[model samples]
Every structure is written in C-alpha cells, then in structure tokens.
Target: MPDTSFPGAWSVDAEGSAPPFEQLRARVLDLVTSGDLPAGFRLPPVRTLAEQLGLAANTVARAYKELEADGIVETHGRGGTLVSAQGDAARRAAQQAAAEYAAKTRSLGITEADALELARTALSLR
Candidate 1:
C-alpha cells in the first residue's frame, strides 16, 4: 500500500527514457486505481508534489491536468484535489491487468521497444 500521507510512493528514474510527467502520471494513476488512494483521497498540491518528487511544478501540473481530464481526480478550488469515486472499479481492474502484463514482460526480460511494439501490434489488431 502506498503511504497515503505523502507522495512517497512515487519516484522518478532519472536515467529512464520516459519523461518525468509521464512517470508521475502513471504513478499517480496506479496508486489511485489500485486503491492505495481511496475515494475522496486528496493529492498534494502541484508545487508540493513537485518538490517532493524533485520535479518542476509544471511537470506535476501537467500530470494533474491529464489525470483530471481522464476523470481520475477532480479539483475543488480551495478544497484541493480529490480522487473521483466513479471510475474506481474499471480503473482498478485495468490497472491490475496492466501490472500483470508488465510483470510477465519483465520476467521475460523484454526490452522497452519490443514491449511497445507488441502493444502497438495489439492495438492495430483491434
């Protein structure tokens, strides 16, 4: 379970190919969808989270904006950011499936490019 009191569950791979915002977004989504962050759980402010994660505030802000657009969270002005209640089940299931797939790929020592290509191929088949 993630530490609900802080953004301690999130970490950036400084040498990773993925961008900071993308990593932060994924971490936040995973935490929320996995129920580590329960319904009505509040996220730290963008500046606070950025400071915690050693990222620019703009990067964290972009992640928050994207999350809001995806209905994972909602901002209530002075009330701050809260996790949305509606999409939890669906998001949790999807997150679980993706985690399983990622674990399998990692166990197989799959390269990032190959995994991405596999995902692209799967998408194209639909």
Candidate 2:
C-alpha cells in the first residue's frame, strides 16, 4: 500500500494545468486501471489525501465523489474509499472496443497478421 500522510500546506497548481480535484481523480483512476492499486485496496481518507496532496478536504471529497459516480471507486462508512470490483465491466468494454479497433484497422488496409499483432500487443500491455 502507498504510504499516507498529511501534506500540511495546500498548494494547488496556479498554472491551471488541471484542477487539483481533477488531477487527484485522474491519478486514482490511472492507478486503479493500471492495477497499481488493486481491487479492494483502501484509499486514503478524503482529509488524509487532501492534506497529503496540499489540497482542501473538499477537493478530495469531490474527487472521491466523481470516482464513485464513474464506478471506479467506492466508499463505506468510515472505512475509507476503495477501488471498485465492477472493474470487470470496464475491462469488458475495453475488450469490445479493442475488437472493434482490430476490425477497423484490418478494413483500413492493415494486414490480418498485423492486426493480430496489434491486438496481442495491446492486450499484453493490459
């Protein structure tokens, strides 16, 4: 599990690169998607993640809310947030999309051999 700590002072990006809450959301999503954060892995509490990221507690709360809305994460009483097991649906969607891509690529003049290779390589990365 990644270590959790309080950041103490809030310092969101003034450059507008991405809102603090959005960045937090994206990072959590990527972590969950890449399997770096596995299913059932607990997330830092909103206050804890907010403090550690130098953000407002409300920002973290917003991020978690968005994650939950998208079915990427879940919350339970005071137990904290966690990656969703519903990730299976997301994986299925990705597989279907990949199948469509493979067909489209072949139709676009990509050789069957090359398309197969592409699918293999893409699935391998997952």
List the RMSD of every prediction in angstroms.
8.7, 6.2
Q: Please provide TM-scores, in order, for all candidate models, with all chains considered together.
A: 0.66, 0.63
Model 2 off-target regions past 4 Å? 1-14, 88-126
- RMSD (CA, angstroms), candidate 2: 6.2
Best by TM-score: 1
- Candidate 2 lDDT tens digits, 1-126: 555432233345746667888877767776777777778878888877777667889998998999888788889977678778874545666788888997799679998888889779976652
lDDT of 1 at 114: 89
Error of 2 at 106 (Å): 13
> Candidate 1, after superposition: displacement of residue 17 in Å?
1.3
Local accuracy by lDDT, each model: 0.79, 0.75
Q: After superposition, how far is residue 107 of candidate 1 from its true place, in Å?
A: 30
Q: Which stretches of candidate 1 lie over 4 Å from their true place?
A: 1-8, 89-126
